[model samples]
Target: MSGEVRPRRADAQRNRERILEAAEAVLAREGTSASVRAVAGEAGVGLGTIYRHFPTQEALYQAVIVDRTRRLLAEADRPSPDPGTAFLTFLERIVVHAAQKKTAADLLAGSGVDPKAGTADVSRDMRQAIGRLLTAAQEAGAVRPDLRAPELLALLCGVCLAAERDEWSDELRRRALDVLFDGLRPRPLS
Candidate 1:
C-alpha cells in the first residue's frame, strides 16, 4: 500500500463532529471534572474513537477552544459601519459567552493548556482583526489612539470574569462595558 493516507470517510467525519459537540457540552457542564469516557458516552461513541481522534484531554480542549475562537474571529472580521460600536458589541458577546461557559473557562484556566500552543495562528488572526478595528475607531476619533488590541483583549477577559458572578446581570454587564468603553474614548481637551 502507498504511504499516503486516504481522506476520512463521511461517517468518520460525522463521528468526529459529534464527538466535538459532545465534548463541548460535557466540558461546559462538568469543567475539569469531565473525562474522555464521559465525552465518549455523550457522543454515543466508543472510547477508542475519542482516543483515535483526540488522544488526550488537552488536545480535545484545544480543539474546542480553537473552534470557538474561529467563530469569534469570524464575528470580529465582519464589516461594520461603526468600528467602535462593533468592537464593544464583540466584547459584550465575549462576556456573555464566558458567563454562559464559566465552568469551561475556569477549567481551561487551570488545566495547564498553553494558550499559545495550538491556537497561535487563530489567536494571531483574532488579534490582527481587533487591531484593525481599533485602528479604524481611533482614526474616526471615537476611540483613544493609545488603546491597543492586547489591552482590549485583557480587558475583555477581565470583564468576562467579573460577569461570571452569581449576581451578575445583563444590566451589570452593560454598566461595566459602558465604564470600560468610556475609558477607551478620547478625552476632551480643556
Candidate 2:
C-alpha cells in the first residue's frame, strides 16, 4: 500500500461525525467521568466503532475540540454587515462555548495533555481570524485604536477561564461580557 492514508468511506465519516456530536453532549453533561462506552451509546454506535475512530478519551476530546474550533473559526471568517457586532458576537459565542466545554477542558488539563497538543494550527488560524475582526472593528471606530490582537486574546481567555472556573450563571455571564465589551469600545474625547 502507498504511504498516503486512504479517505474514510462515507458511512465511516458519518459515524465519526455522529460520535463527535454525541461525545460533546455527553462530556459536557458528565464532566471528567464520561466514558467511551457512554459516548458510543450516545452515538448509537458500538464500542468497537468508537475505539476504531478514537482509541482514548484524550484523543476523542482533542478531536471534538479541534472540530468545534474549526467550525467556530469558519463562522467568524464570514462577512458581516456590522464588523463590531460580528466581533462581539464571536467573543460571546466563545464564552458560551467555554461554559459548555468546561468539563472537557478540565479533563484534558488533568490528563496532562498540553492544551495546544493537537491544536497549534487551529490556534494560529483563530488568532488571525480574531485579528481580522479586531482590525475591522478598529477601522469602523467601534473599538479602541490601541488594542492589539494579543491583548484582545488575553482578555478573551481571562473571561472564558473565569466563566468556566466560577460556573457563572447565564445572566452573570452576559453581564460580565457586557462589561468587557464596553471596555473595548472607543472613548469620545473633547
Candidate 3:
C-alpha cells in the first residue's frame, strides 16, 4: 500500500462535525465540567461515536477551541466596506467567544493541555489582522490616531476577560461594546 493518507468516510465526517458542534454548545453551557456523554446526547450520537472521534475530553475541547478560533480568524480576514465596523465586529466576536467559552478554557487549563496549543501561529495572524484593521480605521478617521495595535490588543484582552467573568447577556454585551467602540473613535478638536 502507498504511504498516502485517506479522507474520512462521508458519514464519519458528518458525525465528527456533529460531535464538535454539540461539544461546543455543551461546553459553552456546562463549562469545563461538561462531559463527553452530555456531548453525545446533545449530538444524538453514542458515547462510542464521540470516543471514535475524540478519544479524550482534552482532545475534544482542544479541537473545539482550534476550530472556533480558526472560524473567528477567517471572519476577521474578510474585507468590509467600513473599516471601523470590521474592527468593532472582530473585537465583538472575540468578546462573545471568550464569554461563551470561559468554562471550556478552564477545562483546557486544568487538563494539562497547555491551553495555548494550536494558537501560537493563529495568535500572530490575529495580531497582524488586528493591526491592519486598526490602521485602516485610523486612516479613515474612524479610530483615534494615537491608538496602537499593542494597546488595542491589550484592551481587547481586558474586555474579553471581563466579559468572560461578568457573563453579560447579548444585549448588555452589545451596549458595553458600543460604549467601548465609541471611546476608540477620534475626538473632535475643541
Candidate 4:
C-alpha cells in the first residue's frame, strides 16, 4: 500500500462525525470513565470504526475539547456593536456550555495538558480573544478599569462550578451572572 493517506469517503466522513457526536455525549455524561465500546454503541457503529477514527481515548477526548473550544472561540471573535454586551453574552454562553459538559470540562482541566503544546493553541487563542473583549469593555467604561481578563476567566470557571449543582436552574444561572456582572460594573463615588 502507498504511504500517502487518502481522503475519507462520504460515508466514512459521516461515520466519523457520528462517532465524534457520540463521544461528546458520552464524555459529557461520563467524563473519563466513558469507554470506547460505550461510544461505539452510542454512535450505532462498530468498535472498529471508532478505532479507525480515533485510535486512543486521549485522542478522542482531545478532539471533543478542540471542537468545543473552536466553537467558543468563534463566538468570542464575532463583532458586536456593544463590546460589553458581547463579552457578557459570550460569558453566559460559556457558562451554560461548561455547566452542561461539567464532567468533560473537569477532565480536561485536570488532565495536566500543557498550555504550550500544539493541542492547546485553541485554548491560548481563546484567552487572547477574551482579553481583547475585556479591554474593549474597559475602554468603553462598561466594566471596572481594574478588572483583568484572567480574573474574569477565573470568575467564569467559578460560576460554571456553581452551575453544576442539581438545583441550579437557568433562572439561578441568570441571577448568578447578574450578580457577577454587577461586580464588574464601574462603581460610583461614595
Candidate 5:
C-alpha cells in the first residue's frame, strides 16, 4: 500500500521561508489577492510545498501581518537623534508607507479589521514612543499641550482613511500634512 507523504526536510523549511518572503514582497507591492501558486514559483518551490507551509488563505494573511509587523518594528527601533521630529516623521512615514504595504494598506482601507488584532501591541508601543515626544514638544512649546495620544492616532486614522481613495500625489500628501501640522503646532495669542 502507498504511504502518506513524508515531512519536509531542513532545505524544505528554508524554501518555505523564501516563499513567505516572496509572498510578502508581492502582497506589499501588489495587493492581498496575490496568487499562492505564483508565490511558490517566485520562491522557486513547488505548489505542494506552498500548500504544505500555509494550507489556508487566512494562514498566509496572518503570516503577512506577522512579517510586516517585524519589519515595521525594526524600522521603529532605528536610531533617531530628535524624539519630537522622529515622532512626527514616524507618523508621516506610517501613513505614507501604509499604502505601500499590502497588508497594512488594505487594513488602512477600512477592511473592518480589529484595530489591535495582531499588531495592537506594536501600535501601543509606537504611541508610547510618540507620547514621550509629545511631552517633549509641548514642553518646548512646539506642539499643543492639550493633545492626547488617542486623539493624535485618531487624526492619523482620518488622514490615512481619507487619503487612501484620494487622487493626491506624494508631494500633495506631504504638503497637505504640513498644513495639518500647522494647525497642530502651538501659536501665541497676540
Candidate 6:
C-alpha cells in the first residue's frame, strides 16, 4: 500500500459525525426518546445511514451524551479571572449549554452522564479553582470567607435549576451570581 492515507473511511466518518450531530440537535429540540427518523431527517441523511452508524437508539443516545460531555469539558477549560468568577462563569456557560439540550437537562436528574468531566481529580481540581477565588474574595473582603467549593458547586447547580426555568432572563443569572458571591465574601472590618 502507498504511504498515503486512504479515503475509503472518509464517507463513513462523515456519516457518523452527521448522525451524532443530528442526534444532538434532535435530542436537544425534542427529547431522549426522539425518533431515529427525526434524527435522520435533521441530518438530511437516509434512515439506513443512521442505522449503519448507530445500530440502536441507545447507542446513538450514548454517543451524543459522550459528545456533549466532551464539549462541556472543552468549555470548562476556558480561563477567567479569580476562582469565584471563573467558576460562576463556567457554571453559567454549562447551564446555558445544557438548556439547549433536552437530553442534558434530563441528565440533571441523576443520569449516568459525568457531571464534572476532565480528570480523576475533578473535585480537587474544581475545588482548587473555587478555593482560589474564595481566598481572593475573602482577603479582599468581597465574600464571606467560609464557603466551601463543594457548597459553591451545589449553589451553582441550584443556579442551573433557576436558569432552566421558563423565564430565561440574564438578570436572573446576575442576581443568582450576586447572591452566591455575597454569602461567599468576607464581612468588612468594623
By TM-score, who's the top model here?
A: 4
Cα lDDT listed for each candidate: 0.73, 0.78, 0.77, 0.76, 0.67, 0.62
TM-score on alpha carbons, each prediction: 0.78, 0.75, 0.73, 0.83, 0.70, 0.62
RMSD of every candidate to native, in Å, equals: 4.0, 4.5, 4.5, 3.3, 5.6, 5.3
Q: Tens digit of lDDT per residue, candidate 1, span 12-96?
A: 8999999999988886666546888899999999988888888687788778877886777789878899887887776667677
Alpha carbon deviation, residue 6, candidate 1 (Å)? 3.5
Best by lDDT: 2
List clash counts for every candidate, in order: 0, 0, 0, 0, 0, 6
Q: Which 10 residues in a row give candidate 5 its minimum summed lDDT?
A: 104-113
lDDT of 4 by residue, 1-190 (tens): 6798888899999999999899888877766578888999999999888888886877887788777878777888778889889878877877787778653234223224485444566666666776798898888889889997656777766776666544368898888889999999989766
Preferred candidate (TM-score higher): 4 or 5: 4
Could you tell me how far off, in angstroms, the CA of residue 176 lies in candidate 6 after the best superposition? 3.9
Which window of 10 residues has the lowest lDDT sum in candidate 2?
104-113
Q: Candidate 5 lDDT, tens digit per residue, 28-104?
A: 65566778776776788887877778867557766777666656656666656665576677667767766565344
Q: Between candidates 3 and 6, which one is better according to TM-score?
A: 3
The best-first sequence of candidates by TM-score reads 4, 1, 2, 3, 5, 6
Regarding TM-score, does 3 or 4 come out ahead?
4
lDDT of 2: 0.78
Native RMSD of candidate 4 (Å): 3.3
Superposed model 6: Cα runs more than 4 Å off: 1-10, 78-81, 103-153, 165-167, 186-190
